[model samples]
Target: MLLSIIYVIGITAEAMTGALSAGRKNMDWFGVMLVASATAIGGGSVRDIILGNYPLTWVQHPEFLLITCVAGIFTTWVAKWVVKFKGVFIRLDALGLAAFSIIGCQKGISMGLHPGICIVAAIITGVFGGLLRDLICRQAPLVLHQELYASVSLVVAGLYLGLLHFGVSDVIATVSTLIIGYLLRMASVRFKWRLPTFTLNMEGSVH
Candidate 1:
């Protein structure tokens, strides 16, 4: 129940962000919906495809797809507010990333996957939606280039699994993971923390 609630909120927030990106590109309503839905659920869809999970989440629960579309359209009406308080949006995005990571981890655990595989699943779920959105919107991929995004997913998944191994209750493990993951992401943003990045330029020498 707790995970379900977070999943819904996560996708809604993701859809809204995707809609904002579409707005920046001056896309029409259909384009907004496409980008928004892709941003909201693309990660899980890709995960299922890779994991060979039958009947995708949106396919099994079409209502989730409807929710993403509605949320995307709804964002258009409040784009100004969303832009004005971009900090809040960032916080929500952090929460969404945490929730998505936890959910993906849980799915892998349920399938009796290895801990390492679970961590990979979590990172994929947490990062791929925004990745798809950026690719579609012609923007640099934030997860690839920006602050500690995929690392947060890795941390959350490993922590959750470790907690479970130590005999923590599911609810407690989940809640603890969410809180810590969110804080980690926000701190990365506040402190401009990032993984080392490699750069190449015309004037730079390379091996």
Candidate 2:
């Protein structure tokens, strides 16, 4: 029940962000809905495909799709507020990422997969929605960079899985993962922390 609520919140936040991107591009309502739905559910689709899980979430639960579409249209009406309060959205987005990771980790556990594979699923679920939105809007893939986007997912999934491994209660494990993952994301954003970049000269030779 708690996870379900988090999932809905996560998708709604992602859909709103996606709608803002579409609005910036001056897209029509249909385009807004498209980008919104893609941003909200694209990650889960990719995860299900990778795992060979049939009947995607939106397919099985069409109301979730409706929620994203509604969120997109709703965002169009409140674009100004969304922009003015993007920081709040960022925090929501961070929470959403944590939720996405937890959901993906749970999916992997349901599938009886290995811990490493679960971590990968969590990262994919947490990262791919923004990737899809960027691709649709002709923007660069933001989450693919060396920033902590993927790292947060990794740590969240690992910690969640680790806790469960040691027989932690589901509620405690989920809540702890969510809080820690959110803090890590906010800290990274506040501090501009990123993985060290590697650079090479045009004439640099491979070892």
Q: After superposition, which runs of candidate 1 have C-alpha atoms over 4 Å from their true positions?
A: 204-207
Compare the candidates by TM-score and give the number of the best one: 1
lDDT per residue as tens, model 2, 69-128: 999999998889989999988998999999999999889999999999999999989999
Record all residue pairs in model 2 with backbone atoms less than 3 Å apart, i.e. clashing: none
lDDT tens per residue, model 1, 15-95: 999999999999999999999999999999988889998799899999999999999999999999878988987998899
Each candidate: what lDDT? 0.93, 0.93
Clashing pairs in 1: none
Residue 174 lDDT, candidate 1, scale 0-100: 92
Model 2 stretches astray by more than 4 angstroms: 203-207
The TM-scores of all predictions, comma-separated, are: 0.95, 0.94
CA lDDT for candidate 2 = 0.93
